[model samples]
Target: MASAFIGSSVKTTKGPSVAGTLAETVAAVSRWGNQPSSEDVEEMIRDSALARHAALVKYLENKLAQAKGKLKKVEKALAKVQENLEPTELPTDLETISDEERFLFRKIGLSMKPYLFLGRRGVFDGTIENMHLHWKYRELVKLIVKRKNIAQVKHIAISLEAESGGVLVSVDKTTQGYAIIVYRGKNYMCPQALRPGNLLTRRQALARSVELQRYEALKHHITDLQERIELVTSELEEMEAGKKFEVHKALYSKFDDGSIPNEDEEGEEEPFSEVEDPKSEEGKLEGQSMIPADCNLRYQAL
Candidate 1:
C-alpha cells in the first residue's frame, strides 16, 4: 500500500504550493525506497530562485523608469518657474544718450545757420535752438534756474572769496543786484554787473530758505514720532508683562481656598463665666461673701 501511495503522488505532481510540493513529488519519484538525485534537486532550486530574481529585476526596471519620468517633470517645472521670475530687459531706444550724436549733423547745421550771426559777436548769444542744443542746454539752464531760485528763497546767504583777497557776496536778500563789500565794520553794495561775480536773486534765496526750513521740520517731526513710538512700545511691553504676571498668579492660586482666621479669633479675650463650676466651691463661697459685703456697704452709705 505504501508503494502504491508513492506512485500515485509521483503521478499527480500538479497541486497548490507547487514549490513546496516539489519535494514531496521528488521523494515519491524516488519511490521512498532510495534517495533522490542531488543534481535534479539543485537544478529545481536554481530555476525557482532565477524566476524570483527575474520578476524582481523587472519590477525595479519599471520603478526606475517612473523615477526618471518624475525627475524630468520636476526639471521642466523648475525651468518654467525660473523663466517666469526672470527680469525683463528695458528697450534699447529708452536708453539715455547724447542728442547731438544721435541727430543728423545737417539738421543741426541748418538750425544753427540763423544763430551764426549771433555767435560771431560776443554780444549775441546762443540759446537752445536745435534738438541737440536743447537737450544739452535745457538741463544746464534748469540747473542754473534751480540754483538761482534756491538763493532767492533762502534768508541766509553765502559769500565767495575773490582773487584780490576781497569777498564777493553771491547771495544777499537785503543787498539786491549787487556784491556787498564788508570793510571796517561797514557794508558797501557794489553793482552786480560791474562786480564781475555771480549773484543770487531774491527768488532763489527765498526758495533755498524755504527748502531748508521744510527739511529741518520734517527731520524733527520724524524724530518726535520715533520717540513717541518707542515710548508707547515700551509701555505696552511693560503692561503685557504685568498682565502675564497677574494671569500666572491667578492660575497658581486657583486651588487655594479663601478661608482665613478672623482678627478677633486669632487673639481674643475670654468672656466672664455665665455659670460657676461645681468643682470650684471655694470660688462660689467667695462670690457670695463679696455680694453680702457689697449689700451691707450700700445700706450703710444710704
Candidate 2:
C-alpha cells in the first residue's frame, strides 16, 4: 500500500508539471496570435506607401507650379527681345540705284556739305525727321555715323535707306567716320508727316536698349537657375531611392572655394577701453611723446 501511494504522488506531481508547461505554451501561442496579422501588416505598409506617394505628388505639383511661373517669365522676356529687335519704321518700296545716279549723288552730296550726327541713340525718330529736313533743302543728304561698330553702322545705313525712303548711293569709310550719302529717291515725295508714328524717341530707344540687355542677362540667369533646379531634383530623386548623392560637392563646391563670411567674426566688437581725458596730466604727458625724451620724462615727473 505504501509503495502504491508514493507512486501515485510522483505521478500527480509529474502530471501537473506537464499540464503547467502545456498551459504556458498555450499562453505564449495566444500572445503570439495577438500580434498583428499579416494582412494588417500589409495594410499598414500600403497606408505608408500611399502617404509617401501623396507627399511626392505634392512636391511635384509645387515644382510644376514654379516651372510654369518661370516659363511665363521666359516667354515675356523673349517677346520683349523680339519687340526690341524689330524695326520701328514703316516699310518702304526701295528701288535699286544705278551707278551713274550713285556717282552724281556722291558728287552733289559732297558739295552740299550739310551734315547730321548719329550718337548712341541709333536712328531714332529725331534722326529720321532730321534726315527729312535735310532732304527738303537738298536732293542728297550726308549722314555721319559716329561711335558705332562697323556692323552696326552697316545695319544703320540699311535701316536709314528703308526708313527715310531714300536711295543709298555710297558708303564711304573715312577717318572721321562712315559717310553715308543717300539720295532723295527719283520720285521723292515729301511725306505729310515727317516723323513716323512707330519710331521711338531718343529716350525710348535708350530705355529699350537697356531693357534688351537686362533681358539677355536675365535669360542666362534663368537658364542657370533651371540647371541648378534640375540638379537638385536629380539629387532628391537619388535620396528618395536610398542612394547617396554628393550635392555639396557638385553644386556648392564653388561656394566652398570662396571665403564664407563668419557671422561671429563680423559681429565681434573690439574690446572697449576708456580713454583718459586729454586735459589730464597723464594724457598730456602721453600726447607729448614727440618731444625730446628728457623733456617728456621731466614733464611726467612734474
Candidate 3:
C-alpha cells in the first residue's frame, strides 16, 4: 500500500505533497516491482548528488559575480574619498597667483612657495593651503618641501634647542583641526587639539626666537626714545615759562617799584626805590630786592 502522504518532500525530485488512493497504491506497487535494479538505483542517486552539487556551484558563481560588481562600486567610492582627502592639485601659475593666494603665501613666507598650493577646500573659503599643516612644518623639511613638495614626516613635532619649549601645530588633510603639542617638561607633552602649533621644527623655533628678540629690542628702544623726548619737552616748557616770568618781573620792577636813578639826588648814596631791599639767606632767593642781579649803580655823598 502507498503511504498516506505521497510526494511530501518537495526537495526530492517530486513536486508538492499529494494524497494517494488505493488504485494509485496498486500502480505504485506494480511500478516498484518493475523498478530498476539496485545497481541502477545506486547510479541514479550518485547522479542526483552530482547534479545538486552542480546547481550549488552555479548559484555560488552568480553570487561571486554580484560580489565583484559591488566591490568595484565600493572601490570607486573609496578612491573618490581618498582623492578628496589628498592635497589639492598645485596651481600651475604661482607667478600669476591670485591676490588671496599671494596673501597667504606672504603670510607664511616668500620662500614657502613650493609647498603652497591651492588646497582642497576647508569649511571656509580660500584655495591656498599650507601643505605642512597636513603633517608638520619643520624648518629644514620646510625648506625641502618648499622646493621638492614631497617629504615624509613621522610625528607632528616641534623642538627647540638647548631647552625644549615650543608649540607643535599639525594639520592632517584628513582632520578638520590640527594638534597643538606643547612641551611641558623633558618627556611629557599634551597633544591638545586647538590652534596651529607654532612651528614643527627647531629651526623655526630659532628663527622665531630671533624675530621676537628683535621686536622686543625695538619696542624698548622706542620706549626709551619716547622717554627722552618727553624729558626734553618738559625742560623746554620749564625754560620758556621761567623766561616769560623773568621778563615780566623785570618790567614790573622798573615801572612799579620806581627803582630809577633820581635827578634831584643825582649823587645820592642810597638808590631811590619804592620797594625796600629784603635780606636773603645763603642759597635762598629773597623777595622784592628792588634791584636786578646784573644792575650797576654808583653812589656819592648825600
Q: Top lDDT: which candidate number?
A: 2
Q: Which stretches of candidate 2 lie over 4 Å from their true place?
A: 1-93, 110-112, 213-302
What value does the lDDT take at residue 67 in candidate 1? 39
Ranking by lDDT: 2, 3, 1
By lDDT, the better pick of 1 and 3 is 3
Candidate 2 clashing pairs, residues 3+ apart or interchain: none
> What Cα-based lDDT does every candidate model obtain?
0.29, 0.57, 0.31
- Model 1 per-residue lDDT tens digits across residues 1-302: 99998887885546565555777788777775665588776555544443433443344344345435544654554344333221222222221223342232212322221211111011101211221233332211100111234333221111111111111112111211111111110232232233222222334333333444444443553454344445434433554354422333332322122222233442343442333212211111111111111111111100
**Pairs with backbone N, CA or C atoms under 3 Å apart (clashes), candidate 3:** 133-171, 134-171, 168-197, 169-197
Give the TM-score (vs. native) of candidate 2. Answer: 0.44
Q: Model 1: residues >4 Å from true position, as ranges?
A: 1-181, 184-192, 195-197, 243-302
Listed in order, each prediction's TM-score against the native is 0.21, 0.44, 0.23
1 against 2, candidate with superior TM-score: 2
The model with the greater lDDT, 2 or 3, is 2
Deviating ranges (above 4 Å) for candidate 3:
1-33, 87-302
